[model samples]
Target: MKTQSVAIVLHDLRGGGAEKMMVRLANALAEQNTAVTMVLLTEGGVNKAELSSAVKLVELGSPRTLSSVPRLAAYLREAQPDRILSALTHVNVAAALACAMTGMLRRLVVSERNTYSLDKKVNTGAVMKFTYWLAPRIYRRLPNPVIAVSGGVARDLVETESLRPKDIVVAPNPVLTAKVLTMMDEPASHPWLQDPATRVVVAVGRLSHQKGFDTLIRAFAQVADIPNLRLVIFGEGELREELSALVSQLQLTERVDLPGYAANPLAEMKAADLFVLSSRFEGSPNVLVEAMATGVPVLATNCPSGPDEILDQGRLAPLVPVDNVNAMAQALRQCMEQPSDNAELKNRADRYRDALSAQAYSAVLNGSVTVWGR
Candidate 1:
């Protein structure tokens, strides 16, 4: 067998679910003695340090990916890796354009980590509309495999972009990692988590409209009068001020805490009584699976693509409608009353183990016939 050189391209090693998966895959490839290089279209992010020494890091140092096309094409022309994998919309488009410009024969794998149609539906702004308009044109013309992290995402591509099933590979996101297992045992420093009497509900994601943190805040407000309960959100994003104001408006200033971005959210998930995902839409949420891996019960808004598939139609965990405060509140009450069994939840999470996902991805990179994420 010959060693293969692989390049994983992304906008950044941001704390987003897709970024984390990219880092994990790159690390896994390195561990297998494959030459791995992480190509970032941007400079820095929280997960930058998470890469092991075995993997090379190349920063394009561009604020936006459009400006980085020449740099990306140049890197591809010079490095000439056997395979290239890129994630996210902007970065994927950039990778496609770069590969085209370089006219490289290297196999290119691009991923759509979100449901474009649903995301556009939720965010009906001019920018989002333009992005929706532009993405399909690019994806339709791309000649390589398009990785969709979930079946729903794959279906979206077929329906929205007119891509064939053969062109889309539905590979589930890698969830379990050695670091995650190690972190699960580590204690969370929050005072609420330490209290045996206190029931802490945790939600982790960027503070954005798509995440529906405001909806989660409102749902928590409905149950705030419950004794020994606290809502702690572990993330930071553009909506911090708006979400904080909603918390204040609901008079949950003391009961709810937005501690910004947590470097080690697994510890918090391990310690917390429950984990919730209130996203308006998601391709495939890593945190939902991570929370289940920790043996903590999960409550997620059954929004596009991921949560329903993850929760197995609400058999493993509870699901609510997107932005439905009353429904979310009711579901929260029911969850508090009858928590999910830890072992069962962990069993569900076991399906997305990193080893399995890594092997599937490795097969793709090595040009092996593979079927996954069915």
Candidate 2:
């Protein structure tokens, strides 16, 4: 075990749920005395700063997934990692190819962070479609079980991607790590959070069709008349103009605001009254867990993958139908009117502790364990 080293491959530490968890996982693995290296196709993202000093960062300096395969193989040949973990679909495919090129397929583990069916809906590029098409083929050929962030993602791999049940391992994202829980205690920078009189409804995600911010904005308009109510969506993406236009179209500009990328959404969540996840689909919905960890009331769209499991089938928090404006609106009103049990929320969030997530990954990489995130 002392001689073992793990290499985590991904497309830079971007501002995405999977990216955030991978960073936390790398940091946690380093803390456990495992030699860890983060191999990036590109070397920069907002989350890069969150990586621990102990974890080495390597840049392939390639533009995208397929182009980085040779560089990744070169890194593998030089570093000779005992195990490789890759996240996100494109990166997973690329890593598998790289591992295969280096004769290290048995040492590689691939993960699907979001529900692929939904991912396909949002990212419809011909190349992206081809990559998703290539994923199952590449993933199924690997010797190690594919790590999935949620049961839904696991199922999608089996159903949509044609992976065998024996090829799957469910692992929750490292959302409520001690570092993150501590970050939740940091001071809130948003002024809306400071006003106790204002009932703030916060949703954190990229402003893409997958996040369903347009649906959330429309839902917020339904309850906009509620005094002191305000909605703030955090994170940046390609659909900013479309979402902003919809917000204005609904005449919700006064009540709704799309504040771009938040370096520390948990801190803002700590101060907000409610946190909503309106994703069209998810693997584990890390933001939901983070909000619950902050003890903030949360509402989610009952999407294909993570929400039902994360919310314990709506026992932990309320879940609405995906893209149903009326149901989401009503849920929003009910959540805000009804104070949540902060203790219960935080306790539920603790199940995905960084230590536990890291332990599962470590075991998988060690080829000693199979199932997790139950």
Candidate 3:
């Protein structure tokens, strides 16, 4: 029998959770003796460190264009991997279309990482909306399977869209607990980690409206009266200037720190006293799972998809309403006053261990399962 090969496609391999998940999956598949290759649509934003040596990195060397699609389709068709898993919605849609155009339909999995509706805001204008509206129809016609990162994401796709429930699979983001533990065990070299007294409240995500760092800033400011508490947001995006302005306007210049994309966020998550997810919406947040793995008590805005589901409907951690500064402040205060048992939280998180998630993905990718969502 010929050795099986799989290609994981993404727009870029920058520091987002979805990108990290792709890297993890690539590494895991490679370790299983599957010939794994990672194809990045853009070259400049690749995070070289996150990927393993076993996995091959193929960069298209530029952003995708109408001209590039045929070239990309040709490349994949020529490679003819046994399976192709595309991460992120836009990339997934593109990969599916490209594969269809090229007539390479062995196994194509489209992973939806965020809540479907937020794509509208992420890409404004009528053209973007039209594309989004057309995406479901286009996706439906493809021979590929759809994978939702969370059950909520799967539900949204099937219930709200024209997609068949049977075609959408929910494979929750895998938690690389061992890797996270190793990173956490290492000494803190970052200047922010040097101080023992600094009460670091960390939020990990791209600096976007969806992640709701602005609301986190507002909540942090309200509780700024608490001495030694510092807010650090990891990850980068277009909202850098806006978030900076908000931090300055709140007069939290001394307290708020925007680290701007830490390649290994688990290090920061482990060192922090608290982890927060203030997203306006999410599909399944890998950061929340990672924080839980680090035994850090998490406080998240009860956003769609990931947080509530990961937190087990607020039984594990505090869930505040989205953009509510007062409620968020109160939640933070409560967390400070009464800390959850780190050991218990870590134990709960261990259930979603990387090995289990890898097995689930392996089963799906290997054609052992038909459907994967609730």
Candidate 4:
């Protein structure tokens, strides 16, 4: 069988989860001999450096996602890729409109990387809120099922976005590449992570409210009695000043540190005593998966989607309620005292391996399979 020509539409090469996953999928598809082209709405993000040489990159030169629809439509008309995949809400809406204009709507597959309704939470600006509000209407025009990163996210689409159950497919985020496994063996990114004398609790994500780093910090303050225990959250965002203020207010200045974005979080996870994801909502947290892939113990909030599924309803690791400082504190104390089975965690992480996820997405992109029951 001949390989299909695929084009992935993304907002940018930003460090966000959706952007990272798209980059990995494009690279993996190219590595597997599929003709892959990445169509970025606007250029310039940290992930731009990570694109594989085999995969072609197309920069639309537009100022924003919606503004690129005309250019994207032109590309579809010219390149006429066999399959098209688009990520996130605004870009998905743009892709749907673009593909429709080019008479290629049937070839387009839009992916939802977060609980679709988080629009009410993540999109505060008027333009974004309206865009998200308009998404369901646009998504309904899709000829292909929307690919959700987790079952919870799929359910959200059906409930909030009014998508039919049959119109969604649950797919894993293509994390845990062979390169990540190698990176795990590298030295810890921070001196505290490398020090055997100190026990580190690591959380990686943007320092924003959605990530709930404030909850993590309060929980850490509650567990300060544990000697040699420290909390390190890696990632930068708009909430850096606010979160740093919280740390100071809680008097956790010494015990907690906000070391902005780690170049390789797996390396930090490899040396840590435990990993925590305190997100309020997630499609499927790649950081949690990365820690599990590193064979490190984890604790996460029982959010709408990803954590519960990844932890098997808390059978594999502890799951606390979102923003519940007491529950998070208790779990953190217990987890810091005793980590879970690394072998089992590693096994669960295997389900999201780059090869397996890439193959599933490949099937979707090629239209060889539909509704991969996840």
The number of the candidate with the highest lDDT is 4
Q: Write model 1 residue lDDT over 213-281, tens digit each, in one string.
A: 999889999998789899999988899999999989999998999998776789898899889999998
Q: Return the TM-score for each candidate structure.
A: 0.92, 0.95, 0.89, 0.97
Evaluate model 3: give its lDDT: 0.78
By lDDT, the better pick of 1 and 2 is 2
Return the lDDT, model 4, position 231: 92
Q: Candidate 4: deviation at residue 178, Å?
A: 1.4
As a whole number from 0 to 100, the lDDT of residue 372 in candidate 2 is 71
All models, RMSD in angstroms: 2.3, 1.7, 2.7, 1.4
Clashes of each: 0, 0, 0, 1
The residue pairs that clash in candidate 3, if any, are: none
Ranking of predictions according to lDDT: 4, 2, 1, 3
Better of 1 and 3 by lDDT: 1
lDDT of each: 0.85, 0.86, 0.78, 0.88
Q: Compute the lDDT of residue 229 as modeled in candidate 2.
A: 94
Candidate 3 residue-wise lDDT, 1-374, digit = tens: 33388888887787567887778877877777789999877763555687889999888865453235665687797888888888776676677778878776557877788788764567776655665777788668756567788888887888777689777777757666467778866554456666887777898888877889998999999898888888889888889999999999999999999978675678788888899999989887777877888887789999887777777788888999998999999999888778767876777676566666666677778777554334
Pairwise TM-score winner, candidates 1 and 3: 1
Identify the runs in model 3 with alpha carbons over 4 angstroms from their true place: 1-3, 62-66, 125-127, 189-193, 370-374
lDDT of 2 at 330: 94
